[model samples]
Target: MPDENTDSLRPPPPTGWRRRIARAPLLLFRAGLGPLLGRRLLLLHHTGRVSGQDRRVVLEVVAYEPDSPAWTVASGFGAGADWYRNLGADPKTVLQFGNRHHAVTARFLSAEDGAAIMEEYGARRPRTARRLCAFMGLPSDGSASALRRAGRAIPFVRLESDPPRRLESDPPRPFV
Candidate 1:
């Protein structure tokens, strides 16, 4: 049996049609609808950490730095999410944002950096920030401290592009 803390942290996985519903966006992206979503969202082409099978997931874009070709994304389901874990195991991945696609490496940011990013994101998109925080089981009180705390709790990954892809035979670990 799982402990109370584990149960609390583990959000129920979507099932049946709901699972398909979640993947509909990925299908749209595959069908060349990426331009429609623009920079607000992106398609993460990743490899499964355990199975080593290819996987795709659509995630919201919290921040995009064009010059560095870096994108910051939050895991609304927290760090325990399968995709997040996959990236941790192997940061080599592909990112498709709008019409641009790049070979990217995932870098986990420090809590302090996450806090600042979250604050700036909230200022730009208040409602979305609140909703995301609530969904992630973080406090959504709309205060700076609360936002910072939530940012610290939730995992933020920076996808930096133009990196050389590491061979599969390489050990499972972050490039950075």
Candidate 2:
């Protein structure tokens, strides 16, 4: 794959018929249901590598590593993928999950480390990681062991959930 700059993996799919078809579902989803369900969708926002502007993507969180509580993102097309490239350049990003926003820092990890974490997720959860890997066409290996050295195979993030939003004032205090 091309280096970070010249990489063809980021942005949209490679220009062609297959590319159009490949991304049709995402387009349809965003057009039809994105607005109604945006708050419920788990979204990630990453800056454009070239434009230096923000870009948002709806993603399904596959697994959260225990002990460390690191989030794992399977880079289906590997480091050459657009999201991966963006994170490589800038690890800082944001995530919208469960009607909440989080400031996050992302880091890539080795295949072994990713696989181990994947294993843990698959073992504990119901095919969240396995399904995601299969959907992304990533190798589903070692997906029950704890991640040993997560450093670029997968993009994992550390997140701080944004504080709750308050609107109306609290009700009158009850007698004690």
Candidate 3:
């Protein structure tokens, strides 16, 4: 029911510099290589509300869960980011990784989960921790607790991938 009966709340796509960046991300990345250079690119396919069709977008792959219920992906620019907004509006989406397309449902991460991951991130990538924190717009409040608090504010999407699908020209299933 996530996408149902939300007629009055509909609006146009995001615009301005963000729109420009979305349109030509390669150029933006070229212009700012340090923070913007990304290796993994994922194509997300979602249902368009007004257009009543499928919408495909290229997103930079961020985080993946180890043995958790969902895999998390952070919006580099924070909550107001377009892809985050779209997934929030509609949970159903498909992530294209190379030639494989994975059907998925996305949800915002719980406060506890976000905090734990933030700690892990700081520990694992200490050299870039401060800059990364600032990039998420977290103020330097001095307390380590402040970092955890900021983690809760930074939006994170957890994607739950669907079961495997079979192709027409595939071999039989492997034995258990």
Candidate 4:
């Protein structure tokens, strides 16, 4: 188990070649090859808080709900991560999963909710959850309580798709 006093063992964001490798997914996303990554990952398009310039990053989908059309992701690098902070500044953004894009609004999940989600994820994907916990510098005992504890520490964001708008040129459908 990780020391309770130490919130995270995660290192600072990557630099140099590590940064390049970390950003490789963005290239694939830009090349319209995001489908190759399937639904497990998504390309987030957000605006820089300071620069007002657009920024993009590929993040893993921690949990997905088809009915809500929502995708939850965690900031492995914690709250100080650029992307996480950027979303706080402006929750409205675009999310690209596979080849489809949707206008989404970020909803920050409470620590309790995050903990539950983490426990469920661990149950569903034990190995991946363990690896993720290790990567985040959290406990990887493959136990529900441990996973929940880790989850409570990590920040989670749920991206919900905005309802699609009808075009002015499109005819309205008649009620069945």
Please name the candidate that would achieve the greatest lDDT relative to the true structure.
Answer: 4
Tens digit of lDDT per residue, candidate 4, span 39-107? 789999988999999999999999999897999999888887788889999999998999989899999
RMSD of 4: 3.0
What lDDT tens digits, residue by residue, belong to model 1 across residues 1-176? 11245226635667999989977888879999889887888999889987989998999999999998899998776677788889989998898898678999999988788889998888898888898777656667888888887777767899998756689899989789
Q: What is the TM-score of each candidate against the true structure?
A: 0.84, 0.54, 0.60, 0.90
Compose the digit string of candidate 3's lDDT tens values, residues 41-145.
556677765565777666655466535424566665555456676777788887655445568899888767776666666566554556656654565343457
Point out the higher-scoring one by TM-score: 2 or 4: 4
- Report the Cα RMSD per candidate: 7.0, 7.1, 7.2, 3.0
**Each prediction's number of clashing residue pairs:** 0, 10, 0, 0
Quote the RMSD, in angstroms, for model 1. Answer: 7.0
Sort by lDDT, top down from the best: 4, 1, 3, 2
Worst 10 residues of 3 by lDDT: 1-10
As a TM-score, model 4 comes out at 0.90
Q: How does model 2 score by TM-score?
A: 0.54
